[model samples]
Target chain A: MPEIMVFAATGRTTEQKRGLARDLTDAMVKNFGVPAESVTVQIIESPRDSKAKGGILFCDR
Target chain B: MPEIMVFAATGRTTEQKRGLARDLTDAMVKNFGVPAESVTVQIIESPRDSKAKGGILFCDR
Candidate 1:
């Protein structure tokens, strides 16, 4: 069983993430053939300043 | 337009990821009130030995 962990760290709210996970789970079950319980989507919320690579934030621009 | 980029870097095939994206997009549209074209899922595949923390790979076990 492959646990699908979605690390959503940007551009969305927690409620949105939950909704997304629900939808994704349903889709995976119905179409992608992944089991309902196997899908685990996690949303790690990042502040507006959190995204950075070498001190440059893509979302800030 | 919001893009749903799914960075799947472990334990899945490319075709499986694509299928997931398609299914996720459809489910988002049908149940979660998101536009179909606004969803963009990207799968970044990683080698089994690529997962590391302080130079130790977890998938090697």
Candidate 2:
């Protein structure tokens, strides 16, 4: 089984994540021969201030 | 080829993302029998306010 983890800032809806998971899993199965059911995709949503670059947070960027 | 997309909140360092990519790729190879070079992992950092749920953003979580 192939496991995939995706982290997104907390603003997208659950439906979006599900869509992404579905599309990504489908792509992996079709292209890489990985079984559709064997692919695991997870989305981790974080806060804007939880991430920063050059002293600026993602919200600032 | 298996294309994997990882979205981070932008707080993680490049090294961290690289490490994650390396580990994820290695796991895929060792357990899922995927070619190391053929597994593509990408990290996308989004703004906290770019996503929302229940009328609130991820940063507020």
Candidate 3:
């Protein structure tokens, strides 16, 4: 199963998220040659404070 | 760079999320010999309706 998981800070509209999922699914189906139904795309959004980079929280960045 | 991404439906408490992140970081550090700071854990939470399995939305399940 090809499952695509997207991680990012929260802010995207539902439409944007839907488009992203669709696009990603399309990519996987085209490249991996998997059925669209077998491809699962999940967008995981976190609050700024929950994620960090280079030892600094995203909220602090 | 070892980045850990967790995908799950929303509902976890802040403390649980924090603990999960910490534990995952520890695991990566222990197994991969990566520095604690080098390990990034991001929990991506999706609304129930946004995620689906087996052609059915999680909210509907």
> What does chain B score (TM) in every candidate?
0.58, 0.78, 0.91
DockQ of each: 0.23, 0.07, 0.25
Q: Which digits, one per residue and each the tens of the lDDT, describe model 2 over residues B1-61?
A: 3445754344555665666566656644554444787677876677776645467876896
List residue ranges in candidate 1 displaced over 4 A.
A1-17, A26-61, B52-58
Kindly report the root-mean-square deviation of model 3 from the true structure over all alpha carbons.
6.5
Arranged by TM-score, best first = 3, 1, 2
**Candidate 3 on B1-61: residue-level lDDT in tens?**
6997777887887667666776877788789988888877777778899889998989999
Query: Model 3: which docking level applies?
Result: acceptable
Tens-place lDDT digits, model 2, residues A1-61: 3456754456756665566666666655554455688677876667887755468887899
Model 2's CAPRI class is incorrect
Model 1: per-residue Cα lDDT over B1-61, one tens digit each: 2345443336765677667778867755664465687555665556667655447675755
- The model with the greatest DockQ is 3
Tell me how far the alpha carbon of residue B11 in candidate 2 is from the true structure, in angstroms, after superposition.
32
Expressed as tens digits, the lDDT of each residue in A1-58 for candidate 3 is: 8888788888899999889989999999999999999998887678965675443456
Q: Rank the candidates by DockQ, best first.
A: 3, 1, 2
Comparing 1 with 2 on TM-score, the higher-scoring candidate is 1
Question: For every model shown, what is its TM-score relative to the native structure?
Answer: 0.51, 0.49, 0.58
Clashes of each: 1, 6, 0
- Order of all candidates by lDDT, from best down to worst? 3, 2, 1
Give the candidate number with the greatest TM-score: 3
- In candidate 3, which residue ranges exceed 4 Å CA deviation? B5-39, B43-61
